[model samples]
Target: MRMRAAILFEQGRPRPYAASRPLQVEEVALEGPGRGEVLIEVAAAGLCHSDLSAIEGIRPRPLPVVIGHEGAGIVRECGQGVTDLRPGDHVVTVFVSSCGTCRYCVRGRPNICPSGFAARAAGTLLSGARRIRRLNGEAVNHGSGLSLFAQYAVVARRAMVRIDPDVPLEDAAIFGCAVMTGAGAVLNTARLEAGEAIAIVGLGGVGMNALFAALAAGAERIVAVDANAEKLGLARQWGATDTFLATEPDCAGKVRAATDGGLDTVIETAGTIRAMELAHAITARGGRTVSAGLPASDAAFSYLHAQLVSDEKSILGSYMGSCVPERDIPRFLGLYRRGRLPVERLKSGFLGLDAINEGFDRLAEGGVLRQILRPNA
Candidate 1:
């Protein structure tokens, strides 16, 4: 079957948005899944900031790659030996894959699974041939482990986590990326103790999820800081105990005042130098500052050596919130079902595959929460 998809071919160019540059959307011959593989008819995909990064050249990828990592859909085909799942299952895709026997996977750190770079970035599944192709005989690269920007995707069976058939695919799409990153940062990385104080800077999809996770973890006070008032307001609606407009001249100072002795943990989700500086300022002695954001390569924050050493402050760069997706994704979904995660509130824009560029535009505008794509629409 042929599929329509967004293809990134060059750097510094806007993602082929206009009709003149409209993404090539045509049918591609389907290939059978190899061992341990499953074919999914993508129902909904997310326009993640990382996709923006790929377009912006902050993170470069091979040309003509289908660029989406967070997606949910129904299984269409199951390869040989796939006993645990079957067709018609609703599922979400995970970028991190586990060999299961790898040292990291054995240690329960699937995020650091040894083949992570090759497994996700190789532009294809472990089988070594592209599953998506053009009728004209061209091939498309898989942008992460799952090139879900297309109508159909082929991925490792292990990369999928089954969800209740009733939960809307749009709501589940963001879980693969933003929600997992934020919520996992708290539940796995920071693990904010009961009643601990936390401040999350940058309320984008991931930052907002972090705030919600902190609340779930029993943090007594959750102070969320963001320059955008719209997002700050959303943070409040999503269980942020306190919301602070980051534009305040002394916002970090106010954060410190909100939690005497400073915030027990400061989550720097903005991935900006300014946000990191603020995170350092408001972090209490022995507090851990977890950085979930990905800033530009040259970005840096300055601080006195003595301050970090004497205060026992630890700054950690977290990738994918240190989550084991197989385990955590299901748990996150359970939280959503129980009224704890509130996944539905994160939807800012719902668009079709052709509207993918507009989704990024809304996200860049600074107020939108998460922009989702319905490929089959």
Candidate 2:
């Protein structure tokens, strides 16, 4: 089959993607699903910061890859031995495809499955196969095992979870990454409970979702922090008890004061060392600080070990919100259906494949939330 896809051939392109054109929409050859895989016609895909990281060389990947990890689609065909899902079923893509036999998968933490990491790093399916290629016969790598930026994708069976058809595909698309990571950071990683004071740093799609999850979990105080005032305003609209601009000279002090000393937990979603530092500083004694963001591979942060031991503060790194997609996605969707998790409010708008460069430009410029790409449009 032939389809149009946004392919990133190199990393660290200059900003104003509208000019640099990091991702080129080109006609590519796609293969059918092999064993234990399925073919999906992508309904919608969300533009996430992780994708931007790849473009900026913050997160490097195999070049000439189709870069999209968050998406929802309809199953168009099934590979051999796949009986759990059928053609025409709606499903959401999971960037991490766990091999059930791996130690992490057996322990219920598939987010860090060793095999999954290798597949993503190698830019191939869990089966170690390349299903996309250029018209000139050069093999193209799959990004995060789901290469959903194209009109269609061939992914491992473990890379998708069946979803209710009634749910909006655009809304469900975000659950694949931002919503799951943010909300999971609150509910799973932090184990936030009623009356717990919590703060979320970075008011992007993931941060806002963390706020929404905090409210749903009955958190006592929720402070939203961001460098952008406009994003801070949006946080207030999304039910944040308070908002803080990171640009304030005493932002950490203000956050501590807002929580009447410090917060019980602080979740950092900004993926910056600076934000992680602020998140740790604002956590009260005997509190936990969670980071769900993906910083650059070579990036590092320093913290005072003395304070960590004296204050009994714990720092947890949360990848994919420590989520088990098959279990958490359905649970989160149930919350959405009951109107508890209003992720729909986070949608910035929709874009076609041709406007994908502009979409990244908007993401890089800030103030934009989840921008859905309608590949079939």
Candidate 1 stretches with Cα past 4 Å from truth are 14-26, 297-303
Off by over 4 Å in 2: none
Error of 1 at 269 (Å): 1.6
Prediction 1 TM-score vs. true = 0.93
Return the TM-score for candidate 2, rounded to 2 decimals: 0.99
Best by lDDT: 2
**Candidate 1 on 1-377: residue-level lDDT in tens?**
66677776664566434433424455566677888889899998887778777767777677677778998999989998788888999998887766777888889887877675675567776556677776777877878778888888888887778988988999999899898899988888987888888899888889988987887788888888989998877777777878888889998788787778688788988878888988888889988889888887667778888988999999887788998887898899888888888878888877887677666666656768788888888
**How many pairs of residues in model 2 come into backbone collision?**
0
Score each candidate by Cα lDDT. 0.81, 0.93
Q: Compare the candidates by TM-score and give the number of the best one.
A: 2
